[model samples]
Target chain A: MADRGKALALPVTLLLVFEIWARSAHLHSDSLAPPSAVLAALWSAFADGAILTATRDTLMSAFAGLFLGGSIGLALGILLGLLQPVDRLMEVTIEAIRPIPSIALLPIALIALGFGYRMEIAIVSFACIWPVLILARAAVREIEPRLMEVARALKLSPADRVRKIVIPAALPRIFVAFRLAAGIALIVAVTVEIAINPIGLGAAIMAAQQGLQADLMLAYLIWIGLIGFGLNAGLNLMQGRLFGRAALVRDRT
Target chain B: MTRPVIYWRIVSFVVAAAFVGLWQLIANLKLVSPVFLPGPDRAWASLVRGFTAGDLASKLLGTLEHMVYGWFLASVAGIALGALIGSSRTARSYVAPSLEFLRPLPVSAIIPVAIAMFGLTQTMALFVISFGAIWPMLLATIHGFAAVEPRLYEVARSLQMSRLAVIFKIALPSAAPDILAGMRLSLTVALILSVVCEILAGLDGLGHSVLLSARAFRSADLFAGVILLGVIGYLTSLMMSFAEARLLGYRRGVL
Candidate 1:
């Protein structure tokens, strides 16, 4: 732990110096509020419930998209993987469309879905789905043929084979894909919210910036960083627990 | 399996064609507002106009400049730092935790800080792109270098190779694949960040152009920009993949 603290010293020192200077300088007219000012602004925003509401809305859009898009992507990926016909039919089109950044679709989505939570959720979902689907499909296709043959030889029921063999085999890669998708989802959610000026943390940051409330904007920015950090850490922990067990099982086998 | 593959190919093509055809039909039928869903023809015309006018080229060039610089810097720094840390257990243990702490901070989240520090200048855009590109490159380099077979090091030591010689001769080659993979990851991310920064900061690039068109309600122009951005992204990824294949063809042959 002492060594770990020493390891972190550089980054922490840099951040501390930056915060102090920015605060002391009263940089960018108060719009670039110092760390202390940001904290005060954060307290005020919290008291006013604006921060809470915005956070809730952002989280709602993020998780809703994650669930909806993740499910669809997994199903489509499985279909594409298991059925060669589906893969051939859809691969080119998916590839063509997949390269388009999710943000690029925002204007059309805005026009079609209008400016609201639904639009935000749809865009986030669309963005999140592709990576998960692509990874899942690849994982499925890569499953060893011998494993499938063993299941068949054992006279394992189709459902049993799918549930026991297919899912477990795909789980590790799927989780890896999910890690990537999760980052993309958070990014898309924030960007969509910022672009659309929706009632979320993203919007609050924009509003603060526009209002030249540098401190408030900085506070919101810090909150976003914290949220992203927490989510990644949580996911990393979950991945270790789940995939570690799977890895252990494989080792035993 | 062969029959299924053929069937899937046919189905996928049909589905894709049908989807595009439906868009064309819907636009012609006026089923949706042209403002919302411009047809391919309109988008194509706008794309041609943008290209002919030289605006597209300039904007693309602008975006590409920042992306290339940022990516190049990130790759070099990541590899060097990764090598340093990977060479020593103490360095890895000490540096790893801080890297983890910093890595999860979203590139977008830093825009506010960037704008504050650099204002609305190109520096802000470059900073954001570099930040986005750096973490992946760093992590990948570390992973690559750490995973280098110990036997290679033993061989190098047995040969009385100098530290620099060992790094260049053994460590770098062994880590090349991982470093290259990391570069690939960074490329996509750097591109995305470049676009996003341009949009938010309203810089003169494809992202800014798209946002401008969208806000102006120029659906065709917007779509044209979108399509161009997609092409750029696609082409970049293809280029990276091609390079990787060529450079790493030996590994593929080994496999």
Candidate 2:
């Protein structure tokens, strides 16, 4: 309770101060909006369902990109982790490509995919792929040698071995990787929207900015922050529930 | 073993060569519009021509300047604030919650806010970049300082070390690894945010160049801009790694 109070104290105080100042000064700047006005803006954005539609568009593209990129990364990571010859052959190529900021490909994606969900997803997925691939490859490679020995001794086929052993062992780490990728997916998706694509929360914020609706823009900004916070908290909870102490313990080690 | 390793090296070369070969073939065959999928030769030529004749050099320098300035500002502020909060348990208790609440904010969301505040200027980009890039370093610094061994504090107490001296001498050294790691992440964040801001604001940077080229349907120039950005990313990261190794060299064998 005390901790909660401590946490709320700073933000609440700041908000109150701003509210008083804005009200007293009758600030008319396009950028400055009172807390009350922002709240009203938020309530209206929600009431009319504009924010809802924007949220849906953003989440849809983010999830689609995450799913597409995560699967590819997982498959490729497992292949590279399991196959020494292939890993060796691909190492140079991977290293060479890895440092390129995914945002730099925004133009290429724009050129090929045009403006819409496809363009946004293409960029997000490109951003999302690296973390999952790097972490998943590491996770797979770090699996206990005894597990592989057991699989071999049982004469499990490669497919079954991977399905039954490799995945289960590496899953917790892979999930962590997914969490990381999911964050990137949202970030890249918003970035794509803010840059050019005319869909999603980012676009909403931009629209609000262009319209000089500072209150609405601030409302959208707060909403995006809330969405990011909620996504991270929800994923962290899921990770804790699914993997429990095992993942937590290993992570610290 | 050596033979297979050599063979793998040979295979790696072939694979890379094949990729370029395939791209060239596709371009030659006009599988995709040259406007959309320019050949590697064209991209390379464009890159060379850009540095030699175009304003690409200036754009590159602009981006580097923006990224470095933002990163430097973030580092200074992050370290100062992090130290202030990290040194006091009460301060951490009060501040950490707010920091946690703020940290998960999608950094790009602030771009619009900055634009509203600064009206699409270089100052807006600087503000957004610094704001976005500060979190990692701030958190890392706090963690590093807070996690310092109690025994060190005891020793410092025995030595009658001043508060500032203790922080500067003991805490800072112990926190170097985490702080360095944070700075590295912050640098990358700064670079990405700088690019995003430049693209949105139509600033004089590689990002703006790429956006303009793409809009003009100059695929070769667009590709060249992207390659230059990638090269910058690669070189900066390489430099960071070298710096990390140098600073953390003593801890290498110990770890």
Candidate 3:
């Protein structure tokens, strides 16, 4: 009975119903193309090199921003976490600025950098940095002082202590922050590209929408979704493989 | 070192001031075109003018309305669903995977579908914002409820408390922190999504105004809109934090 009930679950049922609706309603190609038509459109878009260039451009900008922003955020977070004066000095200002959505910086970025990859990259980096910085700082602050004391007792240098005690202790949370930041980076990247009308997947989707090619737009949307899902899934898998035991240990403590 | 810390604060202030002051200097120097990057003074003047002329207010109100409506609906729905799922392990097993799948999908990716389904209207904007806002609330609620002590549940069950009563009396109080954190996240996402939807869909809001100013090369007005968005976002977060502190005062007793 339990198996039967589980087999008739909500998502599967919804999917089946949606498929039937798609078949029956005959959704319009220009505005509301069916999923089947969207899949075909996706194939055609991929075959034509439209998907390739756009995907590459989008990924490149996102990756560049992610690396730049994540590294800076991690370094700063650790620095502030270690230094009480720095944390105290920066706390209020960071709090004030942090709430301002990175999208709000679009106009300034555009004015300073112009409407291209540079502007998109700046926006993505700004958006991705804050959450990661916050998480990393918190993770650092949460590190047990006893570990640091033990390292000091052993006459370990600052660098060695950081490497052996701080990094390993903070690594799990940092990775979690990275996972969160990756999702945010991708989202901001796509949105910035779309808003800026750059030559990327976002641009393609906007173009298709403007041209009233719903099928093509839907295809682009699906591709972006798949990319986001793939990244997130990959991160989740990595977390399970690397830090799964650490997470359990932390929980127990 | 203490002086350097003070100096660093001063330097940060100077850095921010110099950024604006340099803009004024550059504008005066005509190092580049004023059409692209207007001075701070001009931007402030334009902001005042735009507000006095009621251009800024209307657009701000439009965005605010959508954000409030969308965020309200998302929170209510998210809390309800999260509670339902949190109450039962079977429900969690069934829904958690699907929620996880959907949670990571960029909200922007769904805008095209939303626009297709709802058209380029307030509904589309609301739909997009709500979709983005819901995840944080849902996840927070799940975390909050899951964090509830098992002993409390056992006590409730032994007392033969009604399920609803148990949830209200035991589950909710335990989960309040997680729920508040979730709401804070949702609030930020809602604001971001509201602005993005307005910009991309060409809807009537501060985002659209920013895009309009940019296209017209009205750099001051563009900056003004950005400033307004920043102010609104900052205020919203402040308000949320204050509310959380006030409402969760009881939790300090437990700790």
Candidate 4:
């Protein structure tokens, strides 16, 4: 933990330098805010509890979308993984769809579903699905041939094989996908809000920017970072609990 | 491929065609509001019209230029800083907190910050894209270089190779796999951030055109714009994989 302090020292020093520079330089512009002022802005915003509300709104869309997209991805991945024909038939389409950044769909989604929760959640879901689908498919395809032989010898039905063999083997990758998706979902949700939906932390950030509240905008940015950190940390903890630390490791090789 | 697999591949094409046909049918029949869901024909016409008017081409060029520049800057910075931090544990220890604090922040959260600094200009889009693209590559490079086998280092040292020689000949080759993966991810992020900043900055780009089309009730044009972005995204991704394949030919292909 003391080493952690060493880790933070550099950043703290940089911020302090920035604070001194901003004040000494007397840059009374909207472009720059001293670290102290930014902190004060963060404190005031937190005191009013507005940041929490905006945070809840953002998390709601992200989680709701994550659930919808994650499940669809899992189901599709399983289907394709177990059935060679299905995999062959869908590979091209999936590949083509995979590259489309969900953020770009904001305009179309806004037109189709209108502003607010529906449109925001839909775009978020689209963004979340791709990583999950790609990872899940790879996981399934990597199942050991020996495991399949054993299942075959045991005369296990396809459903049983999938349930007992495929899912367990793929759980680690799926969880990784969930992590990636969660991050993407949060980003997309916030983007939708900032760009078109006009609700949540993103909307708050935009409002602050337009109001020319540089300090307040910096504060909102901090809160957004905290929320993202919390989500990632929570997921990491859950994955470790469910699947062991090995599963949470970024690179197996 | 076997006969059934070949048949399945053909089936994929058929399925795609069928979906488009169904979309056209519903669109023309007014089963859904055209304002919400423009017909494929309308979308196609919009594509042609935008190109003929040179509106879409210019926007695309603007977007591509911004993304390419931002992505290039990100690659250079990410790899350079990554190599620095990865080169030593002491460097990593000092830098870890900064990287941690910055990496967790969602890219959207930084849009406002970029706006405050750059304010609705092409630079704002570039700044945000570069910022967003850097982290993944940075993290991966650090991990890759740090994870280089200790024995490899020992051998290089025993052979009296210079620091630069060790890094180039030994450390880099082993780190290539992870660095390549990071590059792919960063490219995708660069593309996404470019579009996003275009929208937020209300700048001249495909994203801006899409937003404009929606606001003006140009549904067909909006769809066309989205499809154009999608096509661009797909081709870039394809290009990345092709490059990855050639770079990692020893492994036959990228993961």
lDDT per residue as tens, model 1, B52-87: 975988998878887888899888888888888877
Tens digit of per-residue lDDT, candidate 4, span A101-203:
8888888887788878888888888887777777788778878889988989999999899999889877887888888789888988887787767889999
Worst 10 residues of 1 chain B by lDDT: B104-113
True contacts kept of 2: 0.73
Candidate 1, position B115, lDDT: 71
Cα lDDT of model 1 by residue, A67-120, tens digit:
788888998888888887657777768877888878777776776787888888
Candidate 1: the clashing residue pairs are A31-A214, A85-B8, A89-B8, A89-B12
Model 4, span B108-217: residue lDDT tens: 67887888888889888888889988998888888888899899999998999998888789877888888888888888888788888888777778988889998998
Q: Give the interface RMSD of each candidate.
A: 2.6, 1.5, 3.5, 1.5
What lDDT score belongs to each candidate, Candidate 1 first? 0.81, 0.90, 0.82, 0.84
Poorest stretch of ten by lDDT in candidate 2 chain B: B1-10
Residue A212's lDDT within candidate 1 is 74
Which candidate number maximizes TM-score?
A: 2
Judged by DockQ cut-offs, the docking class of candidate 4 is medium
How accurate locally is residue B248 in candidate 1, as Cα lDDT from 0 to 100? Answer: 87
Off by over 4 Å in 2: A249-253, B1-14, B253-255
The lowest-lDDT stretch of 10 consecutive residues in candidate 4 chain A is A244-253
Per-residue lDDT of A38-112 in model 2, one digit per residue for the tens?
999999999999999999999999999999888888998999988877888887677667777888898899889
Per-residue lDDT of candidate 3, residues B82-179 (tens digit): 99998887887677767766777778777766776787888889888888889988987877787888999999989999989977899888888888
Question: Which segments of model 4 are wrong by more than 4 Å?
Answer: A23-27, A142-169, A245-253, B1-7, B251-255
TM-score, every prediction: 0.86, 0.97, 0.85, 0.92
| lDDT for residue B203 in candidate 4, whole number 0-100 | 78
lDDT of 3 by residue, A74-170 (tens): 8888888878777766765676567778887887787678777888888888877886788778888889999878988999987887788887989
Best DockQ goes to which candidate? 2
